[model samples]
Target: MFNYAESIASRNTYMTSIRETMAEAQRSKPAVTISMDGDADGKSHRFYTNRDRLEGDVKIVAPADTRFDEIYITFEGTSRTWMERLGVSPAASGRTSVSQTFLRLVQPVNEASLPIPRVAIKGQEYTFPFTFVIPERLLPGACNHTIAVENQSVEEAHLHLPPSLGDHTISTFEDKDDLAPDMTRISYAIRVRVLRKKDTEDQPVVLADTARKIAVSPSIPDAPPIHIQDRSTEFVLRKEKDLRKGLLGKKIGRVCIFAEQPQPLRLAPNSSCPPSTRVPVSLTFVPANAETPPPELGNMTAKLRTSTFFSTQRTSYTPTVSRSTPDPFVGRYQESTLLSSRCVSNVSWEKQEPPLSSSSSSKPVYKAQIIVPIAEPKCKHLVPTFSTCFVTRSYTLELSLSIRTSKHSQPNLALKLPLQVSQPAKDSREHDSAPQDTSVEEFFVPRIISPSTLQQEVAVMAPPPPPPPPPFDRRQGQLPQSMLLHPPNEMPPPEYSVFRGTGGPPVRIPPPVGISPGCG
Candidate 1:
């Protein structure tokens, strides 16, 4: 009985290209419906309708131990035939003159659930009832063929029925390519699809809840004892009691810590904590080596006031420029010692203020054996030469003096007017005997140079010009006979005679006119 709805009503007469009013509905016997749902309800009598080709049939009834998943084939038209053929709503044009098929089974059950069966017949709708699921796994054991519905589109349609013989004898079974190479199995199927497409944007945002994993175990609380006091320091806290009892001042996350040395100490982390809170374990102390200290390290300190356990007795006045003698009760001053009186003394004073000295002079001219500028000053006293007030915040005055001179008082004399010895004019008139004559005159000039190959500097007159002195009184009362006719061996001979020029038989003066005619 292979009547899968009469073979999909003989394949809907090749579906639609219309043309089959069949003689106007056979002379009005009327009743010519064409809506669409399933099982080919187009009530045939050999009516072979056609368009391009659309053959249909659906009669999937698996509701017993239920097993037949998915066979949705909807095409019901009429909202004026879908606005005259698919303009909207097939549930809004998600395109579907639909068809889908998926079914797999081979024995399985757990409460045996199955539903996915819809086969309305012609007015068109087809499948989509429990949305297909028959996998309480294809029931009743001993599988050997039988459940078959494979049509998967040739434009769909083909699901005949009738086959098999149960208990593993559809003919000695086998046929998974004749399996028997040891037996082992698992099978099931029901996959049908279509109905996708819809994703306009996307959205997802979520954050703010910070505090990840912090359960410092072992009962929490071990690190609080740091008392560094050179200037003053201490801060010890181990808190975290209010496990969310009321919810008030909740600040979470802030710990500074820094004082490190041989365990100098640093523990800071308190901005109030509580959100997902777990920051306890504080121990603080800060102040290691304050001001200009090193007098065995004690300028006296106590400047502690941070997150308060109280401290501020910082007495450090190092103004000791002593020559000693100003102790109106222990000489130095900077007193404020007391950390608790309701503890609110946030004190600080770096005041040494007394150091602007030119010796702070007002009239400062006290000169006795005075010389005091402490920072080491030596003195050797004598009677009431008093002057010792070195007291400094900075002061320097070194003026020492001594005057002593006397050996009977006549030692103040400075007069030596005993230098007179004038009288040697025995014959101061012996200046009337003339005898003046000193002469030296010689002229031999020649020095001009231009054509230089470098080196030429001459000023030679070696030796000549000595006897003009024999003319003592021959000057006005003397001979003019050509100077008494030249005696010293003809002295009228030099007018122009010095012939020693031209140095080139020792030839080499040819290098001046842009000379490059080579050949030395």
Candidate 2:
């Protein structure tokens, strides 16, 4: 039989030995640590693109009697994406197609090395201070360049039918994030490595390496506001069986909708007043035709819809032809209704009679003011509206009106308007004209936490209850509490014969039909 337990135990022991040996070796290797200026506790690892320079120190600690051939530090910025087909498609035979691409935002490697050819050092620590300038034109975030696929054959193979059978494909720019759900990632880091000299080898070996993650954010300018206008004319037809009214002809009425804003609404990744921002809307209804009077208005609704789209170009490689051709950039757009609210459901309409005076020239007009509350950013992972090659985010607003009339029970009117949300500009006209102050002052302030305050807050949140009393014996009632709690121990029961039954002792069987005890 195979002993699985022994095998596992042996494997565990071997792994433990290997880990201990590796740890011991690592302890003797040279290590590197980074420290940045303006970071009091040496924990801030963020950098800005607008900044001119990044100053930091590289600390190196070597074991006793350590010799190194060279020591260097390198900085890099990388953006990578891996995408798979989301849904079922004819092109994806049994499995989904996946494509991976790596973009080097900062192509040229920036490295700094010690000038000394060979350095011999005792057990000591060394610090090397350095500074590097941030590139002004570095890409703000993870970005990709994608073009629409134009191959007819590839499109036909992927589609269920001919291109004419379905809606025409529209090209769009998509903006994605570092933590996008499409398994995309963008990262920036700094690495430090050391080369140590080894005995009996002409080439030096890599002793130790260390890397630290850094955050990079580039400033983007704000966009302009949007304006939209829509107009429609609803004609009132003559009633059936009214021959006299048909000869006179139908009456025409006009409905106009106009919307305008001075500035674009802004949505930031981490905004404090995300929900407070609102868009003001004005709704106007006019009864122009004299023959056809305005119907009774019932309810009105204003809905704001937000959508996020993820798109990418897939390149297919043919094994038989030993070549690869890019497929048409297929984009899957998804829309989500972020917010919907009824502006005015119960509308009261007042009938305005035409004036008898001949000089008066006016019609009945009804107006209402609506303020649509903008949807707040639900998840902290939400990115500002942006357009990129692979991903895009857009928003739309819809207004619906319900009309109730005697003849027609329910009549609905709808209008769709496009909206553009952007970030506030850093240098607007108002900011540029503001006065500046050149006063300079310095002061020291300290904050201290009191133990009692912490205790009070904890008590308010969850008060502690008194500990339960120790277990008690009811048989020893009225005894002293200490004696009852800690009673003296007693001896355990004595053991009995193993062969006897459990009823105090074995029953002596007298001779069951024959000699029993003696014969057994």
Candidate 3:
């Protein structure tokens, strides 16, 4: 009634001016800027891989001369993940998060280390060029997951460098989408900090700071093929469908469509272009009678399934997105991309002659093998399967077939198989691998190990327990032994109390992560 809208607009305008003034003031301070030579624009993308040089320059400028105790640059990689629970009531649900800085490399630019003086001169500029070589593997302490498999350790699955993910940097409709959720992120950055001595002689005080983000996608080696269990949601290796001439027609016979899991998709680490792989499949046709033949095949469609797993709380094992867990902070998400759809033609069905004793038998069989040239992933922004403490990514190949069947009620046959996207394994850092022709039958042949080989692998993975330390007193110097065994910051293992409805001794529970992508 009293021109309330005009007053509100005036207030908003006043606040905007205040924010602009503050931002301008902040920008005028002694500024630090970073430039990564390889990137096109500032902070957009600086891509690097293992054993590559990350060269950059840091510049500091001030209107008046500024003094600093020391300048430090840190190359750090950090991972963070969060989960939100959806309960019947909003009050019951909550959000949980976890984070870790797994890789940290610090270099100090003290007065003695650099040629120029430490202070930033007035009206003049100071530049510091830095070069850091990315490592191939992380330190052993980077991951702390419990290992259950024989001849395996936390380093075995998680030591390799993880690609830069979840930042929406690679924006595309197809392969560019990392399939990662908004809640999970793995980031790498070059952080520079200017420090001045604190009056209390405690930790240093930061005079200024700036960071340049990096997009790192390390070339990881090929992992073993994923072991798949029988699940309707997982894979279908073989199936039979009844054939007919027309809609609601008589059954000519049943055609058995079966395929062996295709081989791993090998990818070049530094190829000139995005690589493509082939999917080999075998189909068997079993007829109801000798008069019946295989049904006409339609288009075979290929789709790539991307699965991402993220957790809010620390998990001692890999996370699975398909199964629901009671823990509120862990979850999984999935996305799919259509690769290609092509007409199924030029299939040669070879006749198998029956054995002499079975020649007179009524059974009839035919076999044909086919290889489908899978189309390249939609975009070049694809990341191979990799897992870190907070986030994990994997892939699956889905093949769907349309068959010309007689029965109107029959449905199309589909198969979901594990697809391991692999890169050339490095023999060493100096010698890059030149891939030669290798067998693509990563699925058809199961690994066989002898006793000696098993023993050797076990010795490598499961080392002997360390010796107990000498007794130490808490009051004298070191921390209490119990505190060393169980740190106060971490969550203890779940406990069973006698105050429960069913009273018994405490039962140990298996870790919550079950059936991750690569594991069975």
Ranking by TM-score: 3, 2, 1
lDDT per model, in order?
A: 0.21, 0.46, 0.70
Q: Rank the candidates by lDDT, best first.
A: 3, 2, 1
lDDT of 1 by residue, 401-476 (tens): 1111122211111110101111111121333233433232123444455655223332233455686655444345
**Candidate 2 residue runs with Cα over 4 Å from true position:** 1-17, 21-30, 41-49, 63-75, 86-123, 130-134, 139-179, 193-209, 223-262, 266-278, 286-363, 373-382, 389-520
Kindly give the stretch of ten consecutive residues in candidate 3 with the minimal lDDT sum.
495-504
Report per-prediction Cα RMSD to one decimal: 51.1, 32.4, 22.5
Residues 45-123 of candidate 2: C-alpha lDDT, one tens digit per residue: 3323323345687888777556676666665544333345544675763323233222232212223434343453645
> Which has the higher lDDT value, candidate number 1 or candidate number 2?
2
101: Cα error in model 3, Å: 1.3
Lowest-lDDT window of 10 residues in candidate 1?
211-220
Clashing pairs in 2: 149-328, 149-329, 174-391, 174-392, 175-391, 175-392
RMSD of 3: 22.5
